[model samples]
Target: MRITAENFIKHLKKNREEALQYVIDEYIGIVKAIIYNALKSYNDPQIIEECISDTFLGAYENAKQFKGDKEDFRKWICTIAKYKAITKQRKLSKAPFFYEIDETGNAVKSAEDEYLIKSSTEELLMMMSQLEQLDRDIFTMKYFLNMKNEEIAEHCGLTKAAINNRLYRGKKRLQQIHLGGSMS
Candidate 1:
């Protein structure tokens, strides 16, 4: 059968098994590519596969909520794949790995450094969670992705000044949260 998303949606609406299989067959490449781009820096095959699996599972389980052009399915799936990758990134990166594995598989970091790294990361993520969603994304891209202000600005289509303002305000909010005080 032809593999347009419209055909897939019809089969999905009917709860046919082919819808899932067909959607995976037709879209896994693009989905995997989107996920891979998000995960390329880590190079962990297991996490990548899990994110991809979760993406498809999300699509299948929530198929009824998808309403748009069949041709636009690729974009929708890519967005899902990106968020799946982000969730996996959060799980894998909740704490910074202060230690590098040595040649014989021993960690090369001091205990103090590990504690500081974990504690700082936990506090940082907690503070980030309190920011507005767009600010959170910008902060993550800046610090987590190691993107420069120019790159984040370009990717987000905002001016460099706006990106700087977001970073400044985000850091201010982080301090406020850490101090156990409200942003007044």
Candidate 2:
């Protein structure tokens, strides 16, 4: 049978196993990208894979609630993926040994904490703006892209030493900006 969002939803709700294959084929890429954007910083493939599975499982479990409209599939799955990713991120952010039991009682951060993280990210991006373009690019690749120095060096056709120098100087400059010191 042809797969439509309506048909897919019906099969899923009815617990027809083959419907999963259709959903995976149709939606896995978008689901994965959403998860990746959320979990990029952690760099854990296992966590990423688990979140993707959870997202699908969530859709299956909630299939009855969905109207089974194909037009709504993308948005619905995206919402599920976003929440699943956030949940996984919160779980990974809390380290068992880092905090006392009482302090770690709530692993999930409040919405305000999420806002602060966003603000901090914006501030850091703004700080990076003070550096020369090459310095900024190098810094982003190393930190945001989480590329190894050797990988970045190869990409930029520079030596590993060059990458390190730019990172050090860029950091110092950003620090100076933050400290309100005269640029050296």
Candidate 3:
């Protein structure tokens, strides 16, 4: 019996290895993209790759609980990838740092410096969460991913001017929140 999209869920529930392979073949790109986007600051390819694997493993293990069709499965896998990457990020932040020597023989990023950077990033993300979903996504793409306004516009299906306007307003809102003012 061959596995098709229509029967994917049924096969997955049976714990068929082919079903897992089918999912990997079909959705690896989406999984990797979500993991990479979530872990962009890590600068460690190995960790990102590990998170991708973990996401697949999670989906396979949790297959019985999944409902809905192929489109839902794509969303489910993406959600798994996102949470796995976040878990990896949190674990990395809590782990101790080892000093690495640069070409000039100077150590890069003291433990304290790393902690400060991680904490500040967490704070920024918390503030970003207070934004409307679209504004939050635009802010993340523009600032965290370092994507250009044109690219963000294209990705978001908005005009560059709209992207600019949203960014401006989002910044103002963040500033107000930072200054102990409530979001209006």
Candidate 4:
């Protein structure tokens, strides 16, 4: 039977197993597509899975909000996935581990910790535009795409360990140029 939002909601309201499965089957790909696009620069597999789970959880919790419209449902779920991706991206970007290192070798205020992170987002983008193609690809896959290391390895034809190494080195280089003196 064709799944309509009205029918889906009816079954959902009843808490029927078929209703839940139908929702999953119909919308999981949509959620994944939204998340994958938003996180195309990221390479952590779990983040994608987390976003996917959160997408469904949001849908389930907000089932009552699902108007009997397919487009509306897709938009609602995609919105949730986008928000989740942005939140996750902000959290990753603000990691203290990537904070600036002082001449004394101590971690100073984080490169990502200041108001500039929010304000200088465009600058960050500009810097990314300056990276080599391969570096940009790995960086995008790791941070933007949010794929797993294994997934990136398969996509890029490298070992997971090699992907990790490249990501590590590439990020370090970005930090050095962007967060180091004169850039931030």
Report the number of the highest-lDDT candidate: 3
Error of 3 at 167 (Å): 23
What is the clash count for each candidate, in the order shown?
0, 0, 0, 18
Q: Which model, 1 or 4, shows the larger TM-score?
A: 1
lDDT of 4 by residue, 1-184 (tens): 5556668877775666677778888888877887877777888788888878866765676565444356545545555566567766776666556666677875466454554643454345446545655666666666655678899899888899988888887777778778653332
Ranking by TM-score: 3, 1, 2, 4
The regions of model 3 sitting more than 4 angstroms off are 97-184
Highest TM-score scorer: 3
Every model's TM-score: 0.51, 0.51, 0.53, 0.47
**Model 4 CA deviation exceeding 4 Å by range:** 1-6, 14-17, 97-184
Q: Can you give the lDDT of residue 5 in candidate 4?
A: 61
Rank list by lDDT: 3, 1, 2, 4
Q: Model 1 clash pairs? A: none
**What lDDT score is found at residue 44 in candidate 4?**
73
Give the distance in Å from residue 118's predicted Cα in candidate 2 to where it truly belongs.
24
What is the lDDT, from 0 to 100, of the residue 114 in candidate 3? 53
Clash pairs (backbone) in predicted model 3: none
lDDT of each candidate versus the true structure:
0.72, 0.72, 0.76, 0.66
lDDT of predicted model 3: 0.76
